[model samples]
Target: MIKTWHLGDSRQSMVLASFDGRLPEVVYWGPALPDGESHQAIATASAADVSGGMVDRNAAVSLNPEASQTFPGHCGLSVRDKNGTPLAPAFRFQTETASEHCLTLVFADNALDLTLTFNLALEAKSSLFKLQSSLESADEIIVEWLAAPVLPVPAHADEMIEFSGRWCAEFLTRRVPFAPGARVRDNRTGRTDHAHFPGLIVCSQGTGNTSGEAYAFHYSWSGGHKMVAEELQDGRRHVQFGHASGSLPVGRTFRTAPLYATYSENGLNGAATRFQKHARNLVADGARSPRPVHYNCWEAVYFDHKLDELRSIASQAADLGAERFVLDDGWFGRRDDDTTSLGDWVIDLRKYPDGLTPLIEHVKSLGMEFGIWFEPEMINEDSDLYRSHPEWVLGPADQIRGRHQLVLDMSRQDVRSYLYEHIASVLKHHDVGYIKWDHNRVLPVVDASQTEGTYALIDRLRSDFPQVEIESCASGGGRIDFGILERTQRVWLSDSNDALERQRIQHDAALFLPACVTGSHVGPRKCHTSGRVLDIKLRSWTAAQRHMGFEMDPRELTEQEAATLRMVTGWWKANRDWMMQADILRLDSSDPAIIAEQQLAADGSRFVAFAAQMRPSDQVLPHPLRLTDLDPNAIYKITLINQDEAPALSRGAPLLKEHDLEVSGQYLMSHGLTLPWRFPETIWVLEGRRL
Candidate 1:
């Protein structure tokens, strides 16, 4: 028996399910119905011999030919029975419920009294589908492995791309040819570590940046996860992803994390655009009315806190057009450094004499919203909280700590309640507008059960304080996923704010996520992470491209630099609405040293492009940089912003002297203008408006 369902606005997506009297298998999933066809398209595709009848044992069986016979290539549900035997290829089709946008299919094994349900949902406006599964049983059963939405791809998808990275340097793309067998990317760290991101992109043999067919898969889970892309013996490829689970007794039910899959005929950028649209529509609180310009006090005064010094910094930030001022770490109890006082949520009287009231009031008076930082999920062994409740910490009794901190056993209700109350007390007592929530350490002991408790805490926080904004950070870029984004407003991209490094990080991170939800800040001239000094012009230009913010001390800036900061902030404030609402288009560049990105409004009225030179290329001469995603028929006036900072060229600087150049969008994209040669670490911004 088989069933086919049509999904999406244009009815272009088809999900084909076939049941061979045992379990239901998803045979084909992609694109929509062909012209003048209804269910025939799927019926014809699944008619092929999916069973292992024609597969020759001598050729099909690599090592053990009998292994492929009993356990077929595709199994909807993979489980072991009570007698330590794998379940046979048989299941009773129970029932199915369907709606315009969703379908729920159920199957059962009466002997084991176990039931499995697969839920599928299609986004109304795009070809993005979400898959999740749940298992329930009436009797006690030991479940070993469970995966949801095991989707099959065509055989032509021979190229694969996955991301891997370290702390300061993240999102390095790795492309390889998809050979036979399986390739798995696992994230066992309790939190999404900086090492490997949880996403995969598979393309056809000749796919390029903006052309060809591409498919992408990403998990919504922020905890330990595993993504497997396998090419079976029948020349079919499939992808399966879910939370990493261990054997456990299933008394009632277990649900797997949701996996999002999208396809694009227009290449990787087209697929990324679909994902960004889906995410923007599903944000918990919706997009912020107007994204705020933030000023963080971390790099300025790391562990040193003084009321007068903070007041001066806040005043300077407000003067530079910053809308929010955040007081970073070292403001909590006995927390002079990272070594102690992580769990203590109370204010440090020694640092602020009177509590946070003085600093908060002063910041509010300066016309900026006051924000504070907290690390509620971590605690130091020397802290008062850990000493009082030793059992609240995770791991062994004599466990090794990371960054001098132990993970709080969030799975324990008592631990969750204690941290919740303390964190809530701070929010309730103060007129705080934002919270920079930081998770500094990874879980040494992996516990899948703790994920639910972490979600509960965040859900409750959002429910209790609906007005407060939260920025999720796990040592930077660690806890970024749809699950966490549903509860938080923004995410910090990296701890290193060096402009040159950030260009690559933000460029790749924006592949799946939009720039509006990513937090990019300007650091000191001499970046603390890379120890590379960059000019303020380059740093400010790069930061202005995203949810703009400043992390350096305003007092350190000279008069000229301060004026530049003011100008950049003012420009962002004026154009942020369009910036946030535009679709990001990553232009194809032949030169590896140059990275180009564009933000074009949905209605094609305005566009902003940022071009940066990572290092000095061999070709010192200027070349034409063509733009993308513009209306070819419309005439646009291109103006080079912040060009006053450009050095005097031999021809008296064409970019600086030319206030504006009028050109047709067709000409600008095809026969583009040239950019002058500047020093390394130089960034240029071009703004185009349809006239």
Candidate 2:
């Protein structure tokens, strides 16, 4: 017997086939197929020819590749009985469920009484595919590893782009070629660590930003994850993503997180725009519109929380058009520093004798909504909560600490209750509108339930106080994933406020995150983290590229710097409503030194291009910056918005610098714009309006 099924949106489709009532495997996944295309024929054509040394019939790389089937590559599921004896499950198709946009398949291993199920859904608008797998047994079993539904990699794809980075430098992209053996990435760090971002982009050779075919995958689990891109000896290739191996304890049922995948015919931008739209329209749908301009005090004041100093800073920030002010860290417990105050959510009497109300009121009086920081998932031995209940900590008592702190046992009901109560008390008392939810340390043990518990707590709070917003900050960009983003509204992209670093980080992160949910802030003149000093123009424009904010001490800015910053802040505010919905398109600059992107408005009526010269070009002349995703027939009036900021060294009078020039979109995209020459560390901002 043969069974075939397919699900798709307008842009792409996925077809799965099952033979002999066995588990299903994806046969075709790419551009949308014709309405009458035969899925059975596609499945038949997907088969490989048998050879002498190989088994009589090559075992299918089914959804749940089984050891019993003798499938040569990595098996999809690994489990054992309670007594440590391994159980080889042979799943046979039992039932199936289908919906308009979703499909579910069930198979059972009658001997072990084990049932394995797979759920696949295609998001209607974004055309992104979501797949997951679940397992249930009659008796308790230990699940070593259970992968999501496996899908085949296109044979034509030659290289895959994977994400990796360290603290203060996240979302670094690396390209790996598709070779003979398996290329596996196993992230064992309890949370989605900065080292692995749980995303991959597989592209055919010669694929660039604007053109060529590409496929993207993101494992949506905030906890540790494992990804495998393997090429079998016979040349068949498959990709699998799931929770890290051995992360789940012995249980009767196990389920993997949703694996988000999409196929793009228009290159990296096609996949990026889909992910960005999905994140904004679905993941962060509940977030407030006209996202408020933000000012965070971490870089400005560090752990010092003097009321008078903070009130003065709030006044300055407010005058500079900051709509919200967040008092970050050191506001609670006896926490003068990072070491002694985590997990004690109570307001520190030493820092605020009258409690947070005074500072919150002061910030509110300055016409800015108040926000405060909390590291609820972590604990310090010096904290009152930890002193009272040392047993609440996760992992072994002798386990080493991270950032001088231990992780709270989020899985425990009592622990969740305690944290909710304390955090809720503060929210109830103050007129707070935002919470900078921070996770400063990684868990000592990898437990999926811990992430579930954190989700529960955040869900409960968001349910009660729907108006309050939360920003996910795990030492910045550490715990950023779809799972965490579903609960929080914004992400602190990186802790390093250096514009030069942020320029690259933001550009790379645009693949998965939309500007509305990415918080970019202007740091001090001398970046505290990188110690790189940049001009106010570069700093201001970099922050303006996303959900703009300021983290520097407003009092430290000179008159000239303040005026320039104020002018940029005004421009951001004026354009934010539309820019929030704009698609950030990374421009293809021929010049190696220029890192540029164009934020094309959702309506395709206007766009603003930011071409930042990181260093001196190898060639003396500047390269024409080519834009993307514009109407070829339309004429656009292009003007350099920051022409006045050009340094004296830029003596040449480029047409953009002198006055506006009306040009065809074809000309702008083909021949491109010839921007005025500028010094390194400077950016050219060009505004284009369709006419």
Candidate 3:
């Protein structure tokens, strides 16, 4: 017999589970019919004929069978018994409940004393639905594999899109054909590493940026995870995601992370918009506050920490209208470089004889909030913390270190207490308003308990120091996910601050997360990681679109460059209110060299658009770039923001100010304006207001 549960508003997204008088199997999960048609759809799908066709008798009841007798494509629960054999026990259907926005179903394997519960919930005012599963066993069970909310996609979804990248380069999109068999992507680095982000996009053939059926899934987990997209023997497809569960005992109940999934008949961009709306609802209250413009000292001073030099930089940052000042590394313990003193939280007397109080007070006196950096989850073996407590590290007797540091065994109660108290002590002593939390290395072993312990430490900090904001940085863009965003305010998108590289990185990262939660900063003329030189205007233009900040030394800027920085900073402050709350729209262009994005307010009163010419291309004279997400009938006044600044190259600027002096919203988005493409690496910033 099959039972169906639906959780949505006027339109429903249905979940179907089948039981052959014993175990319940999730058979169908996708978009449902409109209000009145849902019951008929479910009844037709759960009919006796459809129920009998799911079983395969050729390999049924065999020891090494390829599939279960009633395998639901993707198994919700797969485990081993006490005798080291796979358990295929029958589960009896239990009770189910439904609320206004949530539906939950439960099943029990009475013989093994294991119970499974699935929660299906819909976002308050969105088409998105979130699914998670939990398992509870009365006796100790050595679970081998388990996945919650296994999703079934239509067989027509032949195109698969996943993201893969390295440290400085993150979120590079990859597309492949969905063939028969399992295609698995795993992140075992104990972090949502730079290699593979915890998200996937599957679409049917001929899907463009804005116009075809698509399904997007993102796992809201920061630690080790695995995402699988497999095509079954039948014409159906399944997408599964969960934490990497190792050989751990199921003490009482183990719950899996939520896999956020959304379906859109309108295409990839439509699916992305739904995910963004859902995230806005879940964002913390502190994060929703206006993100301040910051100045970080990492690219400025590196390991050369001098009191007098930093004071001068602080004054310059204040002059440029920076609201927050951050002192990066080399202020704590014997940490002149990255090799030592990672676990030490005390201020190094050699760097500042009067401690961080003097520097913190100096920055605050300049009308800027003071923030510091910390890597509390790592320790160098040569440091005092590791020498005193050698057993606190996570690896073997002879541990192999990454980035000259070992992972602190956060699973230990003693380790948690030590980190919590020391980090809290710093916050209590100084007038610190923000923290740049850095995690530099991957875990030596994958353990879910350790991840939970880290979460506990962050929770304690938030409870104790509610006024302090934290920025999560795992090297760069490593620990980015909704799991960490729940505790912190923002994330450092990438280490490489090259303007050209950041255009792509920030563009893709903004698909699932709002621009306010992503941290983008302007680096020096020459980026440290890529060693590529970019014009200060190009860098500032790209950075201004997100949570804006400066990562370079202010004193190094020339008088002309300084004036441009000040102007850009002032513009961001005046317009950030609308920018933070605006809906992001990514535009499609025929030439890949031209990348355009728009930020339009929800009320359609104001909008900001950015277009960049990444590099020179063969198609020099491209077509007029059209805008999106604007009120077609409303009249709008458009102006060039940096018309007074010098042109990016020797070639002249586009005739934007001459030809398109004034226009209506419909004419602007439909007819569009042609931007100048004379110079390589050029950027155009346009501001629009409904008149």
Candidate 4:
């Protein structure tokens, strides 16, 4: 799709890109390819673009203009008209390499068909690259890159492009995914990088005071082009690039040749769809997200929960008007906590005389939604399934060793079929309205032979059973990826339930996914990540707008805490409309104690700003706080939740405090009433508005 040329000598190097209007493209950084005279002709067949077969290439073959010869910094590739014009930005965004790996663009198709030939003993290798051609296909994409596999000190001393890894030994979709894999080449002087994603990674070549240099390669797609950034992994470097907004899904496969990465035909669409990110359309007007602000029953009872205990919890939830009740770990067969009896989806009859049916009905009787948890992706070594077909567990496709914690071979067709049938039976048998889909481990080993099929069988399973809402949890944030989001409703923020940990965690997460990302708040005292106490205001504020829920036992709360929760419950029920669709703004974060505020609006007239106060101390300003989203001049009635409700105060009276935006330290900081004072305050309810 995008093509670039690299002209480098022992001294300096220049990389440039040229487009033929084959696709829409953009450039985030400059010094692109200058139009040049034709000097060479193709000896073989050539027709602009080839759609699939990218999986086979060790990496891209074309080069870009103006890129760091030492390290491929954040330069990009874009396609253009025959006149070689640059497309503008819309869906495309400039990527930044922060501490973590940055994935700019991802594209997938059912099949990829490309071929590479390495002479095995030659200095050079030739490959035919193909890409995003057909709009539809649900098969495998084939890629063949590598002169040969690296076998220690190559017996032949030849530069080769061997399959260091299978970008897709096996994959699913109508096409293949632009999977990330790298090939490091050491022809003479040192090692050169080859990656599956775009951007340059500055590897440690014994340079500077660095402890082995490494650059985070950023992958991004915009307006029909792909761009990347190379940032020093060492903490001493901080490159604050602008944030990417709107939508973008580009395809720029990273492969290895040597010197630098190059592209050919079918350049990435800055705002195109990815190989895996298909927006299976779960949102539309009035189509409320299936997520709920309900509590989890685990920490409340551990694995010792009985039917009666569950029913009691359900009763309290209903009293608080909670819409859902989830029955966590223990209920399945003999399984309890994380120890034994996992992989046993059957219910433990000893826990109840009447089985899950009665519990489901009872939860339903309380008029709340019912959901169950399952760790189907894995099994205990002692599981009957393991004993019956141990080969179904993940092991070396070609004799790789170590019997890991039993992982279901979702890559196998038989395993996929069997899992689907069994789970469907359980689901159809219950009156459950939701399923908490959890996969608690990492996948480093895979056996994806033709007989095994794609490990993405989970996606197909969700497609087949779309009736109930699915909340994904991988011991918290483990398996979180864009692919999984297409099939589920929400994901647990982390295994740690600490409110403080969540403040940072949730912020980092929302940088990518949408608001449906859910966070849980265990009650009053210590819980989750931090066994530390969280003030009610703090917990509520941090979790508001996201899916808010209570986890700790209710009766344990002091009368004051119970009263506070009751208020939250009522407020949540009445004002949920705003939380779902309103735009959000960050108010304050100078203090971790002040988690901050978010507001949503239906029209220009209906708006609500929600703020939660965590740690209240001398650090808090004594001055009035000004709200950011406030209308500069509109006067409206404000409700200071607690103050307005005090019996000593009159109704309709001004719990209303005047809020104004003033300059403080070269910034527009809001001046407003302080916390607990406005704990449940409805900042303002605009009758006739301006904001």
Candidate 5:
């Protein structure tokens, strides 16, 4: 009559129930329930009473809501028969398979020969719930819309936070209040685009970074994704995420990407830490420890690749403590600029005259590993690859181009094969250790198959060359998501290296990304993307906040600027072993002008808090910066690492400016730290250790 399943970790539990052999619905999901709790009672308690305007019985908003069931809100599944006629088949539970951490439920519409399956699992270490759904038919059917297993939003949540951004500025959070109707975001860009990053955070009435209840959701998909957060007339709410509608073509079987969700009782940081841990420990592979000081020559030598000049830059980068040197773009085929030579993965003899060997060897001689860039998913009309295989491009010939390029139909095996051979050739012959994989343009059409094909190629290459690490850079942060991170080891967070912009971008992005996998490079004094000239101190400290690196030409640095950068790089290296594993917690700053974060070590022994004064404070006096996630009983010795950077105008004697002070965690978190004043575009670094 009634069947139920429960999946839980130490932190959270999820209970699902099938009423009268119909499709199942999530009856409970939140804090971990006691072992003796009855799931049957929970399912019964989740039922709603009938009203005058409602149907005789409340229609179940099950894992996959059906249109035939008379549901009020958005249906989870939309389908059509072979002849383009709509099919509204109500699924009934047929069978189920269960495990301690995973559960699979299969429901079938016997009359229509349609079978629907829901698979749910709890990641053991991360405590994140993963859910997905699939459809199968005895006859071919066209799937219009199919969501991953739907989950109910807590009634107490008042607002939701979704990520939105553009080139040079990524991971901007937007807060949307829940209204009566659905808040939908349909990204037809055909990539895990910058405009709509496939992640959401629903917070209770009053939630902040350090405290209050929050629920995080991310669709681990790289294709065009569709998100729907809706409220029903009955006050119930649900959220759905899957590939964009029509992304899947007519087929006998279809499936949704894994929807990763986690409940956070300890505010956004709890969810953030889980996602970060999952990304670092499970998803990403071959990430070098100590996260080598990255040096990318993109901003320095965009398309002008000269062997002797690159050797000089590499030598200077190595002197500045760069452990990895990446030759970004313009290394291949007649590639003079963005207008030509995409999809051609070959070393330009005109640039090197010999090959990449001399430059790579020169870089290695300076004690840095060699890395190269490749835009494997794009093609230029002026290139040899496009001329030879014009039919290999995705979408129509008349489709608008992005950055003078077209999408290479990753869905084609031949295309993937061609890319693999050329990309693999370089890896085979040379001692190349890393690849800066770039996707410069959006797809002409929203097709899920394109993402799948890209994954296959990456998987194949990863299988063949497990030692070589890859960094996913879609024109800088365009294609960043859990799906891409699973195959690649790192991500170029954004193209804009302006420290002021990065201060906010990195703070907001901390909701899902961790430092080790997030690449932050110090740009030129005048940022190439934003053209904002910032001091070397702000630039160096900002870069040190994450996986530290430098992208600017070392030759441009003044003697003092170079010395300051060297000092910061050395400091980063000194603490990187522990800092790389630290939890980046966003501090709730009293001053809106200040964006700060505390990187607490995994073992809770030490921390470094960075407070960047973005603008002049609204008030004359600065507010005390309170830290989070510290033991109230412990006494810590705190010191301002950059006390000397205080401006001449900052005549006030803040306790931190003079000397290190020992204070209890309660005092620090409550009354907070008092530091010397800093001008706009400057940051204060506070280091603390439990005494």
Candidate 6:
């Protein structure tokens, strides 16, 4: 059985676990504030009048998952404290388990300001209290920053904090290093657990505070609690506030996955305990090799199917030295397009004709791993599950509405059990080596009877499927949190797969998650997602900078382009292990408009710099780029290769040209890679042993 320790309480401050844990086990959720940093401690709740009748007695509410649930707002005089903190849409805060976890919220009338403040908080958290404006290691703990990204990652492990389009969190684990697919064992629990958040976001909405308790006034998407009024013996009338997030609460579902939110801090603690959990997540070796850059046929293939067709593609892929072939969407039950039969897991005969067995065999015959995609968290309005149980939607029966598709109530045990069974069954059926688990819609509501409080649904999934290589997606980047990462290995960086756009996305993505996270670039002219025609090698090399892949038809590329991709594919396959773990050093773009750079460092050595000298101009602009975290005077050899056909140049691209570039504290070189006519670029190398 999964074990948990009981916590102890104390006086004053109501013991936000003042004396919890006989010792300790996991990262404690206290507050998300960074140490030595400060924010307006919410204008101080102690001074507010907090006086009134248990206000609205005739109020009604409900927790149904399908209805249009709304936290009714009232127009009343704004209450101001002695310090004059204006209270509009105030809420009372009191949790049955307040000592266990605290919620920190960022509310700005302006959405952009909310994002800006969030970014500031992220910067503060990254230093983990250090007063500098750079990235590195620190220990003010944070399992998942609420305001960060939905799919969060542990990048530097201690200090750096990452956010992907403000939906996912990424942890920087380099300082301590850990294996990618391993579990983190806690001193508290002899049992180890996986730690990485990746998944779809089911729900998120606004709330208001009406009560005056320190937590008395607050708001969230919750029902079942009634707004009540009462008269005390003092002959004064008072009101009771009802809401979600405390006794009132905020409900979230992570595709029925395990999402542990273990810490929070207001920045005043001697040390944030969540950092300890991060420390625990640290492993003996770094995460690398667990993720591979294989081709996934989803946008590339969609619904149109024929095993022979894919087999033909696979033959070329295998010949190109591709490691795996992922068959995405339309393979399961009658699903042939954006709108069609969903929630049915059986393979369609009209398409595959003969079940997936032959296709699996065909892929296997070509000596490549096989994978599949599934939108398990959602069901179409015309889906089998929806038709069978319309009541499964999350809001009140009469008022319920979905973002588009109906999401399964993973919050329910039966639903959890069923989905779990179906997923595992599919995996075993094909002995599938990989799964690109996709959840296209955000959750509208969760009404599972067996679950309670916070993180109920996610916790349950972690308990159920302990082994699965799931990849999280939400339309594009909606739900990405640390909780999902505990189970899935990677996440789609963003749905914007344009090569040029990917540079920023990749840079921004790596800021928070590990370098192994995948970002695909497949399309014609630009990309289907972006509409820019890019050099395949530029796309491939940029992707090499990440867990890259192509999302285009094999037939579109010229034999030359195909050959070019095959060559990079060769390099990627050979350096898969090295690429995944090397500390990345994103360089200034060779082409100010192009996303380009290099990566280096392994086994405690000086880092190597890889730059994509992409210039829109005709000549190579010889600008010396600052190589990140490098040691000065470390004898290193720089290698450069031509982008076009380099058969003769392949013996080793660098010629005996006198290029003793001088660098200051770190070696800086002015020697530039000659940009070729065909245009994909290759530059940099380690002089000797692994850094």
Candidate 3 backbone collisions, by pair: 22-91
Alpha-carbon lDDT of model 1: 0.77
Q: What is the C-alpha lDDT of each candidate?
A: 0.77, 0.91, 0.78, 0.41, 0.91, 0.41
> Per-residue CA lDDT of candidate 6, range 542-581, in tens?
6666676666777677888888788877776677676565
The C-alpha TM-scores of every prediction are 0.93, 0.99, 0.94, 0.59, 0.99, 0.58
User: What is the C-alpha lDDT profile of model 4 across 81-151, one tens digit per residue?
Assistant: 22434322112112212221111221221122212111111111111111111111122222111111111
TM accuracy, model 2: 0.99
Candidate 5 residue pairs in clash (backbone atoms < 3 Å): none
Encode model 2's per-residue lDDT on 464-529: one tens digit a residue. 998899999999999999998889899999998999999999999998999999999999999999
Error of 2 at 444 (Å): 1.2
TM-score of 5: 0.99
RMSD of 2: 1.1
Better of 1 and 5 by TM-score: 5
Deviation of model 4 at 207, angstroms: 30
Superposed Cα deviation of residue 137, candidate 3 (Å): 0.9
Who is ahead in TM-score, 1 or 6? 1
lDDT of 6 at 536: 72
**Model 2 spans > 4 angstroms off:** none
For model 2, the run of ten residues with the poorest summed lDDT: 281-290
Which is superior by lDDT, 1 or 2?
Answer: 2
State the local distance difference test value for candidate 2. 0.91
